[model samples]
Target: MSKNIVIIGASRGIGKELVQLFANNEGNHIIALSRNVEAMSEFDHLKNVTYKAFDLSSSTVLEDLTQILSEIKSVDILINNAGKLVNKPFLELTKADIESCYQTNAIGVMLSTQVVVPKMLNKGGHIVNISTMGAFQGSVKFPGLSAYSTSKAGLVSFTELFAEEFKETKIKMNCLCLGAVQTEMLEEAFPGFQAPLSAKSMALYIHDFALNGHKYMNGKILPVSLSTP
Candidate 1:
């Protein structure tokens, strides 16, 4: 049976790889959302993939998302992979910078989930929130990631709370606190710093996790990384 999977920020990096991985499978239907719809043209040939233009940080995101949600009867899996990263010293960070990071990483994710949960109420579903290792309490902290880390930490908390709130229900939520991966966001955040894992590799794990994670894991913040950080 083909499962309906929705992935936000699917135009690049791990999100794009995830779309390709799932779309290649015969029994999966992928709905990809990104701000730049044109960037997803590469996947247009895939019969199972559908792309939507959406800006999570926009003020009308909820309204725009509701319209998109109306077209899909149900969602089996929802991956919140959209995030914003601003590399600036804490003292140099502006109010807009922090707000932008939180709006995209935390608030947008929450709103999207809220709209999708009802669709999964009867059929059951899973949510995978992409976070960062920096959000972990004891994890090694990186400079210039104050806003990003803090916003992701908020998401980590929301995942736990959401899972617990829906414990008796068929819906499950978990946060994947990822370590550095070789992506544009990583290079921009820490230039020249090489990450051991590639975006494709991480996407594979996330794909499996999204499909089977609810079986044994719920309300967990699983860290994906090769090193301590």
Candidate 2:
């Protein structure tokens, strides 16, 4: 059975690895969405994969998604993996910084999922939101991630709300709060921090979860990390 999977923020890091991992099976059709179309050119050889220029922060996200999803009849899985990390002191963070974080990490994900939900309503589908440990309650909070963390917390909230709203339906939504993982984004956020999990390793877990997790859970916020807080 071939699955139609849509991966947001698929140009790099964990998102890119997820696309690659899913594509390896050759039975899944993948739509890789990200702002960086060039970065995903590495996947041109994979016939099952397609890349689209997607910007979650753009003012035209809805319009953009309309055009992108025009031809797709159904989607089995949607991975909201795109994120914007703004690391700055509490006072140093400007309105634009905070807005950008929320727009991309929260609003964009919700809006994007809004359109895809229709496609999955009939057959049932899984929507996995990629969040951060900084957003998780009780997790050790970092100082400079005020904007990033808060916005991500919104994603966690959305998961529970969305699940309840669609409980009678087959669509299941969940969020994963991730700790440190070695990726370009991680390096940029923490200059010299050594993360125990590689992007591929973390994506491996997410990949499986996206495929079969809905059978066991819905609207759950699970933490996927190698270390505590």
**Residue 132 deviation, candidate 2, in Å?**
0.7
Off by over 4 Å in 2: none
Superposing every Cα of model 1 onto the true structure, what RMSD results?
0.9
Top model by TM-score, which number? Answer: 2
Please give me the total number of clashing residue pairs in predicted model 1. 0
lDDT of 1 by residue, 1-229 (tens): 5899999999999999999999978788899999989999989899999899988899988898899878889999999999899989999999999999999999999999988999999999999999999898899997899999999999999998999899999999999999989998888778899989999999999999999998898999998888655
> What TM value does model 2 have?
0.99
Q: List the residue pairs that clash in candidate 2.
A: none
Q: What is the lDDT of every predicted structure here? A: 0.93, 0.94
**Roughly what TM-score does model 1 have, to 2 decimal places?**
0.98
